[model samples]
Target: MMHRTQRQIRTDEPSVAAEALSVTHVTHGLTVEDSGEGFAFEERVRGTALLSLESTRCTGTLSGAVEPGRAMMIVWVKSGSAVVDDNPVKVGRPVLYRQDPQRFRWVDVQHDVLRIDRTIVEQVAAERGDWAPGPLEFRPRHVPEGAPLAAWWLMVRSVAQEVLQGPADVPVERERELARFAAGGLLTAIPHWPVGQHEPVMASTARFARAETFLLDHATEQITVNDVAEAAGLSVRGVQAAFQRHHGITPTMYLRRIRLLLAREQLEAGDDRSVAEIARATGFAHLGRFAGSYRQEFGELPRQTALAARE
Candidate 1:
């Protein structure tokens, strides 16, 4: 959840710029072969542990080869263009760089770039049931230039303007949420395996019951659908399908219900804890939201219920 904003690296020396690129972009063995006269490189970066969005502008000619790090980068040419590994990069087209060594030569290129952690892509692929037990692969080409590309472009821009560059004090949860959004958008825009395939299997009654029991047991702990799926021995999609088919609700909703019920029980027991304490003990994040949800589930707010129990 480390957050950095408006970090700038501007230099006129090729070696200095190369070193900066090595650290910021997480590349290794980067060597600059040619730096034409008046060479300049500048980058404005904003990022967290999950992803980074950068605006880079360079003048003159630069050529180098880099050992790709652990990130998957998508570059959108804004003003100028470059050739990535001999593939001609054009303006307005976003090119994806996979987790392989890259050779590049660019002349006066300015790019708006997004680098996402490879682990995030793999996690999303697993949750969508589109991945195997091996390395995740993507088509190393420009995203298709139609609705898909438009949607991905809009999403990235929105996230950059609103979440990354919008405010300095944004919540960590909001950052994680936007990172997941960008990851999901990237998967859709780029071509990958298991797309439009792998329909979830309906969970059996026994498996569904096991999932319910797991939720009830872990109601006071911070858990996710993936945890429930693991406990029930099912895929994430399978567990979601099971919940929809059996209870007409999501697994998250069921967990919330269990938490609310537990909170009510604590109140009825005349526990000497404040409503906020009860809400937090029952795993709610916000007191106001908890009170609203509690009132909706039962007939009164948590404080009202506690007062009645005292009477």
Candidate 2:
């Protein structure tokens, strides 16, 4: 996973020395690393942003601004101290944070920064609203020197190590989940502050919940309403209600959304299958409807998206 980030370098200006900003795509989310080292690197992944610096030692007063729809950000500070609006935040440990319109924020992750995946945060948060952490605000906590945010460091290290050391079984999503869980724990442990709320009930309700498991397992097949209902031992209406209550959407709509999302990925990746073939493979048999839905959701026909991607 890698996000495309904007990069800028300014060596002569007194106000700013040098800068390399990258919005990195790490399994399940986006992270931005900005540092003014001797060099810079930037690339785009799935249309998101990423920034990277060769080293944090040259970084002076690092800061990040996240847009409104960007789920939440989990900041992992490998070194240095960060000040969010003049308040010093302990660095080195992973800090899970979010922001809302009412509570706009300015974060300084200080040194050796890694931004976690927002997609996973938003996805899980959307489904599990109650467990979601609220928007971030300034909080100053004492640092137990030399002990950076250990949990976050370990999680990031493990993911990085896997990227360098593991095999196909080590999917990015798994690494992303590990990071999310670790960050969620840290956020939960932090002290109270006035902030907007997030719902995480979907996560809790879907955790070990049979319906969710079944939906994920069978997302690619021609699963019918009756089949899903039977599998979950509920009436069709009951299952439909469950999806609506949990995901804020109807069951059929949820299925289509997931299917379309999968189809889009396949299309972008240049999968050999044709649009109709891919749609059918993902359980949508009607070519016209599939194409129309694809166009509406992605702002382009399936074939067009694939063609553009190939170019």
lDDT score of residue 130 within candidate 2: 37
Q: Model 1: runs farther than 4 Å from truth? A: 28-37, 129-134, 194-311
lDDT scores of the candidates, listed in order: 0.70, 0.47
Best by lDDT, which number? 1
Candidate 1, residues 1-311: lDDT per residue as tens digits? 45556678988887887777777765545654344557778988887666778888888565666554677678888776588889888777778886776777777888888877776666655554424523565665645643345446545755787656566656777666666667755764665543344333321135655575566567778999999999989999999997765444687886777677668767877878998898898899899999999998787999999999999
At residue 200, what lDDT does model 2 achieve?
30
Model 1 residue pairs with clashes: none
TM-score of 2: 0.41
| Candidate 2 Cα lDDT to native | 0.47
Query: Model 2, range 142-189, lDDT digits (tens) per residue?
Result: 232111222223234444444434443434445555445433323322
